[model samples]
Target: MDVLLAAAAEVIALQNVAMIALGLVIGIVIGAIPGLNVPLAVAIALPITFKLAPIAGIAMLVGIYKGGTYGGSISAVLINVPGTPAAAATAMDGSQLTRQGHAGKALRMSLYASIIGELVSDIVLIMLAVPIARFALKFGPVENFALGVFSLTLIAVLSEGNMLKGLSAGVLGVFLSTFGLDPLTGDARLAFGSQELSAGWSFIALVIGIFAVSEALSMVERRGAGPIERSRVRLSDAAHRLSREDWRHAAPAIARAAPIGVFIGAVPGLGSAISAYLNYGIARALSRRPERFGKGAIEGVAAAEAGNNSVTASTFIPMLTLGIPGDVITAIMLGAFMVHGLVPGPQLFRDNAPFVAAFFVLMLVTTALHLVIGRIGLGLFIQAVRVPNQVLYPVVLALSFTGVYVATNNLFDVGVMLGFGVLGYAMNKFGFPVAPLLIGFILGPIVEVGLRQSLIIARGDLTVFVRHPISAVFLVLGVVALVWAGAREWRGGAARGASAR
Candidate 1:
């Protein structure tokens, strides 16, 4: 009871509240801009937090983390360009909804789902951190390999319409991911004798190229076409708001995704991008009208947003309970914790119970602030879709180039971005799905490293994956996912054939 009171006193301090608001605003702005991501925002704010009180400083960073995660969905809905890697999944449906003149509905769904997901995950983090972290600790290389395999099965699920093209794109992504130095050995695998190639492709540059630059190029082709006439939709004020029916469709998706996000966040290295895509695939697979996915399904936006945003709070679970960083963001937060002389292991919780309580309070407070600030900015954000195509595409092009250059400070990365932009444009022109390629790229390295390590540990015994119970479960799940997807696709094809006959 004394600890609760002490924590409450620190949390209610005006400085802490103000800093949280400031950080959230900064995060939302940076996150909404194409090419500027949350990690960069958090990194820029880290030094500034050095002078503030521990609770105040950490509160600001937490605010940024939560805000940035939600902010990515804004540009995704408006422009078909994801502001963050995780938002890529959101773009699959959010952008389509924009084209269909439901931008307001999509944006609101993203916001509401983000808030609910974050709130649920925060409560889970507070209540189950120790137990979850203990489970996370049990993940070894073999288990991780199985997990990666299960994640890769999502590519098959996503490639329902044309499995061949999807598999090819996924293979290309895995091949591209191999360009850097080998994980086991420091030696380069596919550098092709260029020093720049030795460092491999920059993830930020690739993302901006494939999504932003490619979309801009596609916009150029439609330059003569008039701007989107969103005003003609004649939506009433109530129509813009989420109805009970919308809740009925989206609530189950959010509920399903939140737990997936929390579990992924608790495990180190899985990251929000995987969670976002994984949840999206699962939601679509479970939906009665699976065809609606990738074509402006409200549930799609909710699942993606919820999956990514839920990672915001649960990511702290491992860091707080086991002193293990879940991703790059938590790694930076871990440094911030140490800077404040607040080590985050079990000892710190026992020694500074009041401070830990205070931090938890700050997280919940920041979540509420996220909702208010997001709601206030919704009107302004929706206007991005209202801009003229001729004007918007050019500006987006310049920003994509500028942001990439600023992020890497290297012309080579800019060149890489342009190169991939052409590649992405070609892929789109050929009716190929880009999502599978991205999934393969993101998971390929993890899969390779895990497989290699497991092999080494098990003396080249491939059965090591099935020998471990946790790993065996994931492997079985992967097989089940593949069989399910294949069967579903077959049934759909037969139904179509019968209709034609």
Candidate 2:
């Protein structure tokens, strides 16, 4: 009891509060942007957290996770396009509501559903994680190894429509992660004698480059086009108290999405995007208003918002219990934690229960803060849209550089930021997916470390990968994905050929 009391008291320190607020504000703004996301948000914040205590570092991250999830809705409601993939369902109704002159209502509905979802998931995380971690304690290296393979397989299966492209990105990401000073050995793998290269690539730098710079470059292209419009916050027929039908329609979708979010988030590498899509599909299958799903079904919005944010809270499970990241954003956070001399996984829970518990409380606080402060400030956010692009673009450009500077404290990172910005702009123009790149930068290290470790354990026997059950599973999955992606490409080509005929 004394320990618990001290833990609670320690978490309430002023510094932690400030970190939480800082993370929340940055997260919301970044997440609200069309292309920037939570992973990028976390990555950008990592270098800044170095000055803080571990508790403060994680607290700030917790805040970002919460705010970023809700922030995505801002773009969806006003623009008819989701700022985040999770907001896709929100856009169907949110944009429709805007067109109906009920923009404020749509925004309110999103906030309402999102807060409930976030709070509920946080409760589940607090209650569920310890037991799961305790169970994980019984597993030896083999079991842990199997679990990692399982995660790899699931991730591979869901990779971009191109299995090869997905694996290529993931494999590259893993390999890149291996570049820094080898953990087991003092030797550097790929450092080319440059002092800067010895630090290896900063994941946060990569994130800021790929996400922030990439997105800003793309936004710059649209700078002369126009400014984004945002909606004010108000309750109305569109977002007022849900009717009985709304509850009846929305419950099942929420029920389905919430558990899926928790379970997938518990897994090592899987994250929220699939949870969002899976929830949408579940909502469609169960809806009497199935045809209405793509047209503005509140249930669809409910499911997507809930599922996406649910993962935000739940993804911490593995990171806290297993020292493994649940997804890319968590990967960035994992790096930040390690950098600060905090070990994540089972020991973290035992040694830093109060801090972990505090973060859990802050997760709840994030939802509450969003509802209270965000609701009050909705009008202010809307007014932000009134700022002309000529002015807004310069501010954004300046901020992008500021973000780069914050990471490396080096002007050289600014150049990397610009390079990625141009590359991001080119990819966007060509319709290449940016998510894979973000995933690449985050996951690259993990795959590298795991593969190298596994090989060493097997005495450099490539056959050992097949001999091990868990490793074999992932290898087979990689092979299967290659086949599937090939078949898909072939069919797509055949269709194009037939069309030309």
Query: Model 1: which ten-residue window has the lowest total lDDT?
Result: 230-239
Top candidate (lDDT): 1
Q: What is the TM-score of each candidate against the true structure?
A: 0.96, 0.60
- Score each candidate by Cα lDDT: 0.87, 0.64
Expressed as tens digits, the lDDT of each residue in 406-429 for candidate 2 is 546777667756766676566557
lDDT of 2 at 72: 79
- Per-residue error (Å), model 2, residue 243: 14
